[model samples]
Target: MPSAPTPALPQTTCKSLDDWNEPTHARRIYGNTWYVGTCGISVVLIATPQGHVLIDSAPEKASVAVRQNILSLGVRLVDIKTILLTHEHHDHMGGLASMQEATGAKVLSRANVVDVLKSGKNDRRDPQFNELAGFDPIVNVHAFEDSSAIKIGSTQIQHIPMSGHAPGGSGWTWQECEKGVCKNLVFADSLGSISDDSYRYSAPDSLANALRESSQRVAKTACDILITGHGTASDLLARLDGAKPLLEPQACVNYAQAGALRLEDRLKKEAVK
Candidate 1:
């Protein structure tokens, strides 16, 4: 399918480096998949006839902006039934509590992620825990193992555990159809090996191994379209604007390779320092 035309959205930010929480117009990814997030973060809404399932709820400061953005796409606030989480960081899921209340949707994530959100703090197990931020306590959160999945109507949304960058980190994957054509879609979380000062990626229990394994898993998943936590990670905005191919068979592999390469370089630099 050809990509859709993107409206001219203003170039706005939160006045902080790497934080673009300002609201932007929503656009369709494939058939039922919609991108209703801010300029910096990416939030996916899989709308089904029965209800909807949102991938991530941007940062907390943009809570209302995200809600309005979803509403702009003609989605009823109450119709959002389930919210699938990706990473447990404040930048990624800080607004989950408000989103859960706004839509009255149940939150689902990896078994270990449930604890971090409940405490409204960063996970100590994360490499960047020292620099991470906290958010409002998320309620009605439940745990799902690798074998389990949540659904929206007939769609089966599975949670893929990608817990290297952030402990208990995970991504959401499912299929969406348009004109009797189905495409595999994945809301992949951040896979870069980012950390605070004094943290090493070359330790005995270093997360580098997990990051590499997760890359392999995502590469094998074979998604038609891949969405990352940050729009620039996959050039999502460009893809949506028809600047790039909306469907790329090698996109997942390329994404996985890029993430793995980043980790490889980070480890190499850490060793020399």
Candidate 2:
């Protein structure tokens, strides 16, 4: 099949991070997992006996809120033992450097993302590199590979690579137990094929295929509760309110399938153009 021509990168209008910083109260989504991010982005906290593990740092400007949200939950910033990332996107990791410095927590992410994180630069392959601003650089990050398990106290987090949206796009799966009831939770990465109008998923060297494959892999995980990088994608607010069931055995699969469909549709549109 002939690949579509790679479109020129566009200079999309950049929106203020403030616009995305609508304060969202932190709450326990389930077991030890807490939602500490803003209304638009998602930052999760998993507490253990030793300390806490934080996932995704939101944007830099919004990090103060993230910190306050954690404090509001009665957790001390110094007790945050580890910081994990979903990917190297600014929205997800912009606050990491500051958070790491404040808490002195070890940072972990996929090996592929180390350079980008350290350099505070977007990968040239990213569609929105021109539009997105670089974040503060992080140093001495511990890198892991696919299916690697990290154990802290009694909590074990499995790292799953879900590349395409970014080279190091990843997910984390862990079992949380509360009152003798345990649930397998998966914090899946952003699955949407989002890009500037100048980018094409159908391009010859596009990450489309890897994205689809990773999405499918995430779907196969045993997920009792599913959350994503974006709060709306998983109905995080509703779920936290107890209006939604905690055990959604099919949530992971369904989310992956829907993302695949959206990507397929996007490719079709590009073919016609």
Candidate 3:
């Protein structure tokens, strides 16, 4: 791994929950860890007794800043043992190259995604913009199919298969955090279609039906937290109605939204017919 010439972190004031009032890219949680946000992405850094497990590394530009933010919470780069990629999207896996070089940490993501990442790089006409970022945090990767389980120290991670957003889309469930604290299932960018509440989509009916099924499968699981690949963490317990499952998979919401849109289209067609 090559090292970035410039230092990743500069001298900065200690950052913590007391300093939450201050504008920072990270926020301290209950455990001895921090949640750092990058662009529309966010990652969880766990300070386990064994070492550290970072959910996802941000873009190369944000890697140094993220490192500084984490150190502010009392963790060092050398302590990071593993970097996990939810998928191979640039926003989610962007800063991996820089972080790996600086910390010499192992990178992990789905095997199928590596193929996509490689294909993007080889396309001469339209090279994958992600590789050009100079943050290839994934030189070495551990590929797994759907529902595969992996371990990092005391952490037991189960990678759930999610498709549409990317071929090898997946999520992780952390069995234990520092001090035996069990965190919720971390779904990496499981959202297949339908953007956030900014605009309506015009997807075909067949696509909408498929999305609904995807959501149904995802929402069936029981978890406390829903971590979106785009940096939003939703507490499923609070969002759930008595009838709905809490911490449903990302597919649940993505499909529901698309289904609603498709339903409207069907009703309109019926009216015309």
Top lDDT: which candidate number? 2
Q: What lDDT does candidate 3 reach at residue 217? A: 46
Model 1 Cα lDDT, one tens digit per residue, 103-163: 8998887887687878898766789988987899989988877636776668888777787
Model 2 weakest lDDT span, ten residues long = 1-10
List the candidates' TM-scores in order.
Answer: 0.91, 0.90, 0.64
Against the hidden true structure, what lDDT does model 2 obtain?
Answer: 0.82
> 54-81, model 3: which lDDT tens digit per residue?
8777665567767776666666788888
The models' CA-based lDDT, in order, is: 0.82, 0.82, 0.53
Q: Model 1: runs farther than 4 Å from truth? A: 1-19
The superposed Cα distance between candidate 1 and the true structure at residue 260, in angstroms, equals: 1.0
lDDT of 2 by residue, 1-273 (tens): 111112432212214223457666676777878888877788999988888899999988888988987877778899998999888888888999999988899998788778888889987788666677899999868888777898997779998888878778889999977799989999999888888778889999988998899888888899999988886788766676676876788999999998899889989999999
- Per-residue lDDT, model 3, residue 252, is 40
Count clashing residue pairs per candidate.
0, 0, 6
TM-score winner between candidates 1 and 2: 1
Candidate 2 Cα outliers beyond 4 Å, as residue runs: 1-19
Q: By the lDDT metric, which is better: model 1 or model 2? A: 2
